[model samples]
Target: MRGYLAAVAGSEPLTPVSRDWARQRTDLEDEVPVVHEETVTGRRYEGDGIRELRIPRFKSVAGRSGDLTQGEWAETALAAAVLADARPVLSPRWKSQQRLTLGRFTPVTHIRVVEIGCVDASRNVLFEGTPEEAHHRYVRMAEARVRAVKAGGDYLPGQGCGACELVDICPAVPSRPGFLGVDSPPARRRSWSMTTARDYRTCPARAHLKDLFLPRAEAAENTPAIVRGQAVHTAIEELHSRSPVRACASTDAPATPEHWRAGRWEVTGFQARLGTQMVGDHALVCPLHELPGDAQVYPERSLVVHDPDADVVVVAKTDLLYRRTDTWFLRETKTVRSLDESDPLLAYPQLALALLLAHEGAVPGTTEEGTTGCRVELERLTGSGPVLTELDGDDGELLAQARRIVTEHATHWHADEEYVARPGKHCETCPVIQWCPSRPEKSAA
Candidate 1:
């Protein structure tokens, strides 16, 4: 009766679809894109839907060689062939490889500026000249280096592993044999990945070696987290620039002559002040100063300081500065995997330094008054929401601890010992292990 009714209507009866129907819809179809037949080797299948393939010589060098390069090639070729037939080819493995390749080749530059101690930014010159002059000197030095490399002049070997990327590839220098290794010299080594270098301020020795000493061709091969972090930071800055600023109502009269610095300008209903700090009576100093009205302040990102005494400079391009009545706040954006309250590495000392610097640079000799506490609002890029915490006396102590740590590490680093590898969980992901002494055998063996 059902068959007769279906034939009359020219359609199947209305009935529930079995699980198999759904399963078949979801299941990937078997589609072979490429088939390779070798004389000695067996048949090989490659393409989108092909699940299995038989290839000889795969087992012979599987352990020795990191990856089955030949199998991969064959699979890729087969996938292309299958794709050409207008059928979707499954290339999950190839897609992953392409992603890795893209990540590796991506160019990222990490920049960190740390103001060491209280170097008068306005008066104290970096290289005994103007900023432009110093920049020119840097460019000239770079040019001279290029000319030297082109001219095939005498190339001086850098001290320790500060120069060689393939240091582990080659034999360790006899004099500095114990420098990086645990059994060797007692050098204080800090191992950070290229990613870390781009994201944060790493050890100067490591940074110089990888960034300045290593050839551009070699350095570009490895993508450091520091570089990625910096790129993110830059993007945040640009976003902040485009964001609209909400201005507060003006209550008090315009700042008096005594309150205003020389050549100051009041534009957009905000007062901008410029001033310089002087070391002595004879020296005329002018520091680059930018001060917006208290209403115009926005705090977006908190700066981290690694060292205070080692002349390390740390600066942050703030995104949002919040002000409520007389209180001032800073907001800093970060792209971290996770944040822990106990992570002293991200403490408020760096933020304190920024506040202190901003205060001193603007009002000169107002560090004590500026200690009215600050807020570190951590906004995770890939998270549910932002975390806000008030930085207080305890936070100040943490900053002091960070300062001490920096001082101690700097002292150890400058001493006449080889660079010791500070081995820990960080070493597992360290890229410079090829040049690290601690992993000499593990890396080479």
Candidate 2:
């Protein structure tokens, strides 16, 4: 992004004023440095031709710059139309940066608006044309998407519940006062999830830094194993999302599992092959297998519930949520190099949330009477083969164990004010170590 910015800013004397921008000077090939910042409303950019509405992508996730869906194009076009119609204004921040005298900023409408990407500063335009053209595209393509967003219906319990003011009264998120089993009052309203719990247990600073959305080292975060796991999940998810839902076949595994590619995630060699085996294993124990065609399946569904007593929103993203007639089953899938002899719930604490939701009959569509029709399952795809485990949601003993695991994980996190670092081996792959105050310095080799 800095490279692109520097290229466009095109400063004189081949010298960029900002030290951050100067860092990219060596790598920047096209430098048309300009101090003038253009804006429509609050937007800021430099240069001309078709005025651009840049979509900034900071993460090295699987995606392209200009390959947008129709709805996405429509949305971007609508925004571009707004930019085209509005007059430009010089931002106060830019003026301050230039150390210029503040004065009335004139508004001048531009004839065209173009949507572009900031990742590589490429001329890969998603949309470009006149304001009228953009508006017509939006009405024809994106208006329904806009309408659906505004016409909110069912109460969804998810990550947003933590910041939601109506969580106390939300019909979907069942309030489980004293759920975290914490005696002290909360320091502030916060959200809790298996990921947060796991990260906090590993290192509080890791959790805090992640919550702050600090830039991470992509190489460390997207290791081969991690990418392989993601690929396997993506393949399974795509299969589950098929129109007129069909059960995954044993032969459905990728033909080239040794070099599998899912979206932007490409894995090769051993990891890729193992991921393929995992995908195939999933077919042996697919929840949709043998189910009726009308069976409803929600893959990668997020469930949120509020704990008013602890002032935390408990969030869980289940791998699969499917219903067979009256009973609803929540399935959690795992891909492991080898299956070890350990408590499944303890090995993968995320399952605790699924178990608790099932036991409490909290998932949407659970029978009003109780958890009679709710079931929880664990599916492991190991090197040997696939193993399926079912946890009776109505089992009191299992429910107690699940509750204990969740509370144990949430207690310290809820009480923590300073997410102090616990640097150790985990620091080797810690994505946010760059921002950690306690990060250990490397010794001279």
Candidate 3:
């Protein structure tokens, strides 16, 4: 009880009784309560009364005045009732002795009421509530904690990777790309990008390993798919991206593209296998050094949305976002051999996240036509044309899905156990197979 009290002491007033209590009658020694056949005994208190809102315990309090809030007293009162048998009551102090006394704690009734009140520095009365609710919560929390400890379960590092501070010794941290490695870029829990959204949804365990636990594997970036994807996105970013003007740009170029974003990035096709692997595993670089003087399209632009409900920052850099005739068009490109809209981006999170940011006016000019009516095209370079899909859902439905995915991913990452490992064909293509024990053995061709 005192620990809980100590945790939140002094947010408001709890007891109205004055600490500078004065002796009213010569029979003052008669009021102390009896406990365990002992004369209501406690440590002798030099002060007339306990300080207002301070938990009645043997804490090393310096003096009666401090910035303590009244809320602490409420918490203290609850703790006193829950921890009624604690040693603070053994001291010869006045308040400590009366805690178990003849007030309301009786054998016939289990209800324990500890009256508490306090006055603030402004001379305002602070805490006033009864100890019943706080005590109930305290008991429930205590039982839950005790049960968990006895079960021998402990907090794991992947749990709350975003908030954890002890990553240095965490076992799940990867070897090569320890956030310190320059080759492996730091990633966010909710990058607001389609890849991150899909990564967590498809293989949660792999997501945790790659993003939270394991250091990035060495030479992973030299692989064919990674090199090719980067080459592709870089090509497109320079072409259709509304990304900020490059430092290498000529002085005559317009720094700001018209009505489009210039900076959004996606490292897609992770572990993706082309029909036949690249023999030398070299990057397919296709640079567009020249642009049409009258180009209206913009390539990549950064977008950020803070989902108030989820308390997470959703971020994405649009591959291509353009406004046309009061209608906005969102384009996402891929370098895969095949592209299909049949398996629509689950909840179309990337586009949906962008749409939400655009709708809320966080990213202006995302869609003059409106979020639901906007057009999103998945431009697969290997295919003849981009597969077309409309942003179909309402804002609420999309936000709800994003929130659920982001929250569940973070919660699972930090949970005592590993994220659920559901095996499927995708496991064959999982990038973190080195650390994923659940990966199925592939038959030699």
Candidate 4:
């Protein structure tokens, strides 16, 4: 009985269109119509009786690589009339094709964004309006790159892993030996971090050499100031899960022998400045400490999101994340020499990305998500006290600015000829100072 019903369902009449209807998409293939081998196209749907759409078993309605690229959108637009979040049912083309391949289904969490075509209105007429073109500029850039490549410029080292053989000699690549067996030189994909982004803005050559090519400096983490900063950051992080007072009694302690060995400050001095001294209208810690008992904390949460405008992936590891009531928050902690109203860290890119993610509900945080927005906190644990700056919880302006900056940087990231070393204030602290060919000494020569 089951086999008989399955056969009737498989042969049931429904609208069929050429396989190319789902295969070739103009979005990916430079707007060219693609013809496919499968012939079943052009079926008409009539009075609905148990309406269902049949698709290949292995693929998704969202589409994937190769011929199916963007094909899911076709299924999406076609099925938009009535069905939504429709799970495609998999079945063999013929009864004898395979008895084992009877029925399988895959589910999606949410389509994220789906554009359903008009079913009630005229279908034959072309409707020209489009989705919110927030990233249209980046789309144009992608198109331009395609044009550039076809004109004999086949490749360029993007802000990502440049697969070209010339990466070894490329100035955009670092020239230093890595630490141990680990090489952290940035590649074309998953390459742009907050640090690398700053490096690129400050000095492209330094970015190429230190961030891309050279080995990370040995014991860089052991620097006195760095260690102290790490201690403060650790204290702040663990404070979310455990009280600073209770944590000191066990291995959960924030200030450790590591502080004594850090040699940056007398342990007493460090504690006085960090623990006893800092003051503010309401320090970052105050809000953190006041957070409700049930509020969850995510420490050093690493985030990666694609900046479509720049056509690059932007990566960030936030110092801390927390939620209160229903609102989510992201914070960046800094043990700085001083804090001012105009502190550069106030407008930092990492915070911007975090803000954007929180707003988009890209990762878990707020129960309210976009409606409540994410609060961004920048705090400096100074000798004077902790100085804090808060962004409007709902302000998305900073996020937009961050995307623009990254996009602008990415537009020029592929320029191999522009890696000419230049001395700037940034050189004083650059890790790869020895590798720079444009240093004052090298320039004087």
> Which one is best on lDDT?
2
- lDDT of candidate 2 over 1-445, digit per residue (tens): 5635633453222221111110001122257553322222222443343344444444432344446677666566556654454333223443334532323322323333333334444334455566567668767776677557555787667777876767777888888887777776876778889999989989999988887655778678677778887888888989998867799987989998778798777899999889888888888888887787767889999988788888888889998998876788999888888997899889988887798877666788786554347788998888889999998877889889999999899889888899999989989988889879998788878
Instruction: List residue ranges in candidate 4 displaced over 4 A.
Output: 1-190, 218-227, 241-284, 290-294, 343-347, 366-371, 396-418, 423-429, 433-445
Best by TM-score: 2
Model 2 RMSD, rounded to 1 decimal: 10.8
Tell me the tens digit of each residue's lDDT in model 3 across 1-445: 4343443355433333322221111212258642221121111121222222333232333343355554444343334333332212222343432432222221211222222222112222222233444346445544344334435653332234334333333333322221111122223333223445466668777665665435444454345555555654564455434343221222212222221221232223432223112211111221113334343455675544433223233446777665554555566655555655444445344654554444445443543344434455544455333333455435477555544544443443333245667777766667676667687667898
lDDT of each structure? 0.31, 0.71, 0.40, 0.44
The estimated TM-scores of all candidates read 0.31, 0.69, 0.35, 0.45
Against the true structure, candidate 1 reaches a TM-score of: 0.31
* Residue lDDT tens for model 1, 1-445: 2322222243223231111100001222257343221111122222222211122221122233244354443333332222122212223422322311111111112111111111111111112222243234434443344334435753322233332333333322112122111222223333322222332343333343453323223343333433334434443343334334322112111243123222122222111111100001001110101233323443343222212122222233354555444344555444443455565334433443334334322211212364444443433332223344444433556546444543333343344243445555544555454444465364554
Better of 1 and 3 by TM-score: 3
Give, for candidate 3, the lowest lDDT window spanning 10 residues.
279-288
For model 4, residues 69-167, the per-residue Cα lDDT tens digits are: 343433334333212222222444433223222122223221112211221111121111122221242243334443444356423234344223344
lDDT of 3 at 132: 49
Worst 10 contiguous positions by lDDT, candidate 1: 273-282
Q: Provide C-alpha RMSD values for all models, in order.
A: 26.9, 10.8, 21.3, 21.9
Question: Distance from true position, residue 19, model 2, in Å?
Answer: 33
Q: Which scores greater on TM-score, model 2 or model 3?
A: 2
Error of 1 at 89 (Å): 71
